[model samples]
Target: TKVADEKTCIQFSIRRPKLPSSETHPEEGVYKRLDVAAWLHHLNELGQVEEEYKLRKAIFFGGIDVSIRGEVWPFLLRYYSHESTSQEREALRAQKRKEYAEIQQKRLSMTPEEHRAFWRNVQFTVDKDVVRTDRSNQFFRGEDNPNVESMRRILLNYAVYNPAIGYSQGMSDLVAPILAEVLDESDTFWCFVGLMQNTIFVSSPRDEDMEKQLLYLRELLRLTHPRFYQHLVSLGEDGLQMLFCHRWLLLCFKREFPEAEALRIWEACWAHYQTDYFHLFICVAIVAIYGDDVIEQQLATDQMLLHFGNLAMHMNGELVLRKARSLLHQFRLLPRIPCSLHDLCKTCGTGMWDSGYIPAVECTGHHPGWESCPYGGTVEAPSPRPPREGKKGPKVPRDGFGFRR
Candidate 1:
């Protein structure tokens, strides 16, 4: 077996079964509702041959399991949302329903061109009034934009569902793009539901502790790929936690990725990497892409803060994704190295100094590239504490890891 000195690798043929669909299932089959076309198209883009892939099974949190040949796609359908809802709306909903009813009631008798025009009007109206809202309809506008209503519901519900952790600002930013992609309010909601399932671990209940969770996550990463953990810390700041990363944490990179790239990432996440693979990959890829760049770019404290401030807005999503995929491919071809989602998933459930209750992703600014300039005499540094008239210098809260603001 060891005839050659080349690094031994396992050629894993990944075969995922087709999932069930909302339209195709019978009354008894687990409420089938997967969007089959979407899933298949996703696979085609990944260049995977279903038959050959059957040999390389995935190791999920629940453990490695297999489904029947056409059952793959449908398995995730139950998690997708496919209809409209009124769960979280307060008042304006009635008027909106009336509006939709009017739109639907008609068009049955309209000419083809007329139908197109009607739909065009619908889209325009939704974008202008429903999404952004004008002053006249202040009553109709709530935090929930009808376009991304599910994202709001799911995110809020996630907060309520996991009372331990509540809503954060970046969450809204993340959901915005998702809403843009999913036209059906209900489907978007359910797709969001499935998306949130894998995130539950991040919101542990009662007597919850940060160290316990993060430690487990760390061990999982250590068992699978310690280099990833090490690489993240090399970023010179709090590794992935440098900018609070609220953008990547919420909406799952919807805000972090450019619009064009965001859609493709969403399709892929909804299709195969349903867990936090995309989320963690975003951070890992960021550090890797800018490791050397940061060394040269973050020349001063303001420059460093500005560097990270703009990170959310600067990621080249496509390039990073390509790198991640290439890395996975290379890892897969090894005869002995196994492909695992542990490092990736661990990140999903725990962020640096994030859980506020866990230590797994202890966020300490160690990476030299993003650290604030030493407090000596830089002009960009905060002015010397003015004579504190009986007041104390601003103090910072230190996470267990001792990271300060």
Candidate 2:
């Protein structure tokens, strides 16, 4: 099948779900800066809720105010413990800063030959990606923007700190949002470490990890959006492999939404209140919401790629989160969830178990979401390039999507 180009994909209209507001559910509003502080104060005064971070986690699930995300994210990313006091947190920050500096010093102390080899092997890619990542955002808009250089430095230092994973394509995309929030290079580096440690999507993920996530996404689609699942199945092996969704999952929908909206979605996923793999439910929500075009047009693999690829900022982040939350709630309520679904839920963190289902809880970038800058220009949502031919249908290059391993 011939692949559609940007002009063609832009002409294809897709449905957008109704955007929900705080008025829709009185309790569904984001947790503000003061509210975050109060939550911590109450924790200290009351001395541990029965479930430890249960109340805090629930509040985070609703969403966090952009004003306080810098404060709250460390907890969500596991950089700071929920139980730590102000003094303890301060002390830990000092320690982490020292450790980060030591790593930097070690990098500086590398022999000239060692430094040259490192640049050729890792720093080159980091430099290339940092420049292109989120250039549209004012924070990273200028060529001389120190934040850009900071991103390069953090990723490079990370490569030194963890030689095993070294670096990969999506690492910069993951780091940019954290750096924007944390603001400090050293702290951003550590929070990023915490993030990479917690999430399966970043670094050089093992093929097994990728396969497991793809399987879960497929099974969840089957359980929740069976019709869409069947439509994809009809498209053949590419559909079944869900290579398109890999980009969605790998970058955590950063490329799929605008900068501000994408950050909102990210913190909610990091909350992991009901499930660590909430991002998977997000993938399901997107397909369920956006798949009508693919199915109705009978878009073959290439066309489907063009259709979804063009859906970046055009998508309503709130609507996607709402649908994703509803899908998660419904899945939790199911009387008999398949073991595959249950196991999938358990893969990353605590999720609803087979033990009587929890009744309910409500909640819910830039380049904003790109590693290699899918936009390819200043446009908010640029059309994606046509897929490259390979032995296994259309495939993005390893560096482009970062799933080589």
Candidate 3:
């Protein structure tokens, strides 16, 4: 291999496998429950793909002369620090505080009819039957709501609000985050619908719109998770389309991102006006960064249902978002990503947004996150995928932290 001086450079490439572990506990126990500590240990070692590369190169090329660059030292020191980007992120947060304050202030001045018209144009629908599940038992919850309606009414109004991708089942979950963010449920739900429509489809059956979005997602999954795609194919179209991904396309980030977190994310964009790129970048990053791990699990289980059943779990939200943002930062470095936010406006108008709401059959039928992928194929009990033949990553120890199937 050529170095700058063609010295061969002892060129060694390290393809990180997951930290090695032994699953010798053949028959005695259950699979590893989610272990954050152990997982972090593994991640610290395995995910150091960037750090290790830098360290190794410095050692090889500069030897002792590699006097650590002082300015670069902080990033180097905090490479694995948990507060990864907290300072800059906080600055974004401060800006959001001001924007949200203004949005709330503007809402204060809207007349009742004007408020109704504003939401209606945005496509919000509020009726009797569309109640929210989480709010059902909390009698005190909606006291501050500007408009009184059943959770069903609230949800349905949202469906109307974003007719491009209407009434997906899990859409309610997306609202939870926003609902948490806003003191007024009515306002929160409507704003969420507005935000969602801006990012993803909201269920319009008109002109094959839904189908196209479905197909696009399906194709992306094919590239991102072939085995998972195969599993969805095994279940037939209806199962995959109806059960699994209903809420995903409709609510977009509203469903998956929690409130405090959602506020954090939305606040940054409100300040910097960079939400569109951030959301798209994070969405795609999920596909790329976690693709291999998630795919491996689904392939092993061969159970789409199982895949979806545990969707909400497994993720460390703050950490995952950190990785997603990091990846987005990297994306900006690419020629294709964008040289400036200036180009982002032109590109969005004609590029991805104009592509219309093309849908794809996402591996659904489960919950969200990583769970059983029932759409994958018919399930065989207990063990789904074949035994580990040859694979990357250490064999996660059974009954412990490293235990990943």
State the weakest 10-residue window (summed lDDT) of model 2.
Answer: 396-405
Error of 3 at 224 (Å): 7.5
lDDT string, candidate 3, 1-405, tens digits: 212344322222212222111311121122232134322332343232234333322321222111222212222223223234446534544664465455555655669996687566432433322344345424325654433343444465544444555554555554544444343454454455454544334443343655645654554344434455565676566544624443344444444555444433333232222223444433443444334543443322323333332343333344444444443333222221111122333333222221232111123233367465533321222232222323242232122111111
- Residue by residue across 1-405, what tens digits does model 1's lDDT show? 111227532221112222223211121222222244423432433333242112111211111122221223223333312221224221233454454344334435568896576446343333343344222233234665454444444454444334344443344444444345444444433444455454432232232433333443333333334444444456644553334333343445555656556554544343343234433444444544544334433233333334444555466765655544333322222222111222433343222111232112222233367454232212222322222122222132111112112
Model 3 Cα shift for residue 336 (angstroms)? 5.1
Q: Which ranges in model 1 have alpha carbons more than 4 Å from their true place?
A: 1-166, 199-241, 244-246, 273-278, 297-305, 311-314, 333-405
- Over 4 Å off, model 3: 1-130, 136-193, 201-246, 253-259, 262-280, 287-294, 297-302, 336-405
- The positional error of residue 31 in candidate 2, measured at the CA in angstroms, is 7.4
TM-score (C-alpha) between model 3 and the true structure: 0.38
C-alpha lDDT score of every prediction, in listed order:
0.37, 0.69, 0.38
In terms of lDDT, model 2 sits at 0.69
Clashing pairs in 2: 254-369, 255-369, 258-365, 259-365, 365-368, 366-369
The runs of at least 3 residues in candidate 2 whose Cα sits more than 4 Å from the true structure, single-residue gaps closed, are 1-11, 19-61, 203-207, 347-405
Error of 2 at 371 (Å): 43
TM-score of each: 0.41, 0.78, 0.38
